[model samples]
Target: MKTMNYSPEHLTSNRHLFWIAAVLGVIMMAPVAWIIGLSLKDNAELLKGTEAVFAMPYTLVNYANILESSSVFGWFINSMIVAIGQTIGVLLLSSLAGYAFARLEFPFRKTLFIIVLFGLAVPEQAVIIARHQMFNWFDLHNTHIGLILPNLSSAFGVFLMTQFFRAIPKEIDEAAMLDNASTFRIFWKVLLPLTLPAQATLGIFTFLQAWNDYWWPLISATKADMYTLTIGIASSQTNFAQSEGLGFLGAQAVFASLPVVIVYIFFQRHIVTAVSGGAVK
Candidate 1:
């Protein structure tokens, strides 16, 4: 077989596209770089306007103030509880729901799944008003339980796991059945192993969602001590008769962003593999 070589024009066009993409990537990253830069700078420099914003050297005072004086650490712990709790909840509930939907026969199952899919389209923000009233009625407001309740059943998770479960071979189920395995036994012993990639994918997604969830936590949390990172970040900026300096606020932002970023950096490959595995086979 003979291979056809690219014309000079084609090579030039490809190079042009590469350079364009590189330029666009840099453009998109500008704000992230600026935020990171500002996080290391001092308030005296930040409030001094544009010239100071650029002129000030980076410092760790912002980090010190955030750690020493702020309630940031408490918020970090609160965020961990909510994020981990919600993630575990989603993994448990959604996997069971997804498995049942994919493998089991039941009445009105398709219709029920469709309704659940409809639930996906309902915006989280749109439901906050009613949810707040219900939370208050249940006396769940300002509690960690309240922050977690609204997240326990996740539509996206159900859908993702459902699709991935369907992709698994039914022959595996039949083989397990031939061995006299109960449905639950088969699921735990056989099917679940096949879906680890999907589980990881779901776990990461759920963690990120719950970790970064701002509005739900904000509405559900009112007590200063009950505050998660999102609520704490907002609260960090102001209180009765006091305002946090811009540098301190910048540090709060950096602190809030760091953990998630660290998780991504370390487990990025696993996340990618899991997602790709789920998507492919």
Candidate 2:
């Protein structure tokens, strides 16, 4: 096998690229670092100026206060339930719909898919009024089901899974059929396991979207007990102008983002694989 040559000019180019990437990485990470610094500083000190973040006397008082609040835990639980529920619902519905669209012959199959794709064009703002009215009519406001049901119809998830399923070879399905496997069995036992990368990518995104969602939850879950983390944190803020509240707000932002950060850290490999189109055999 031939080996790559490392000429002087090539080495210089490599060094330049490395420094460029380093600078960009630092640029992207600066804001996150700043937020973390703000979270650690005392609220009163932060009120003087954000420059206090660079000074000493950092403390955990903000985090302690967050822990002391009873409602924070409730909000955390609500967020977890909604995020996990939406992720599972999106995975199940999207995978099933994808399988049908990719493998099965049915009436209006293409037309139906086109209509579903149209959902991507329609912004949620346009439908929020109608959706709110319908939910109000059904008295679904302030309920977990109300919050979850709206996001379950994920057009992007369906599209991603459909493309992944289509990339799978037909021969696998044919061989499974020769074994007299039922259609559902083929999908569940044979094909589904092969789509783990896509599932991970989709699940992560769905969970993040659901967890960060604020607007729908703000209106749908008006009750304190039903508030998800986003709304709960916002409701907790007394005033942005107050110095004491600034640190707490920064702490809340950091606290709310921890789960998403942890999730990306754990499943980042699968995300890379999915984006790189390595999900299919």
Candidate 3:
């Protein structure tokens, strides 16, 4: 085979784009790395040497305090309950709704889908007052049940799944139907596995959103025991004051951010691939 050479313009364009991406990657990773570094340093070290950030002595005291002694574990469990529960809820319900919108012949599905799209723009903050009152009426305030209830369905999830569903080959559904597979089975056994990447993508997003949620949980949850890491870290600051509790605050913030970092490190490529495939289709 003969080698082919690119024009100077083409080579220049490719090089420019590659360097731009590299610069962006560095910019993004820098802050995250800095946060991790700060987390490792001791509180005294932190306060005595803000400018000596890179040179400070490191300790695991913060991590230990949050994970082992503080109410961090309780908050962790509560966050998991809301995050995973909401993620599963969104994936399951969204998958079914997505399949319906994509494959099933329904009346006014387009209008319904358009309405659902509005959920993407709807901020959780917008309806918090109403949501709080509703949870209060149901006696769910400060419970994990209350935390998970409000996020049970997501318009974004449904929209993402719907887009992915439309990309699946219609032939699979037809063949499944021919074998007497019910709608439920077809969605569960046939289509769902085919959409695994998208599911993972959605799951990661759902987990992050739930884990980082502060405002609703903060206001709705009146008790300290029900605190999430988002609120846990904040409460720690308020309890000790930011200047007084720099070490604990930094440590807790660092601790809270680790899971998401680990998750993205592992699942990032799958998410990118899934999203790319969805977009291409």
Highest-scoring model, TM-score: 2
Q: Which 10-residue window of candidate 3 scores lowest in summed lDDT?
A: 238-247
Candidate 1 vs candidate 2: the lDDT winner is 2
Worst 10 residues of 2 by lDDT: 236-245
Q: All candidates' lDDT scores? A: 0.83, 0.90, 0.80
In candidate 1, what are the lDDT values of residues 1-281, reduced to their tens digit? 99877999989999999999999999998877776777777776666563455664779888887778647888999999999889888988988999999999999999999999998889988888998999999999878788887988888889888988899889999988999999999878888787777777788878888888887887789898899998888876665123566667777887888878988998797688866663436
TM-score result, candidate 2: 0.92
Task: Write candidate 3's Cα lDDT for 139-193 as tens digits.
Answer: 9998888888788678878887888888888999999999999998998899988
Alpha-carbon RMSD to native, per candidate: 2.5, 1.9, 2.9
TM-score leaderboard ranking: 2, 1, 3
Cα lDDT of model 1 overall?
0.83
Pairs of residues clashing in candidate 3:
none
Please give me the total number of clashing residue pairs in predicted model 3: 0
- Predicted structure with the largest lDDT when compared to the true one: 2
What lDDT tens digits, residue by residue, belong to model 2 across residues 1-281?
Answer: 99998999999999999999999999999989888898899887877788999999889998998899778889999999999999999999999999999999999999999999999999999999999999999999998999999999999988888998999999999999999999999999999998888888899889999999998999899899999999987886756655337777788889999999999899989777767867543
Best-first order by lDDT: 2, 1, 3
Q: Candidate 1: which pairs clash?
A: none
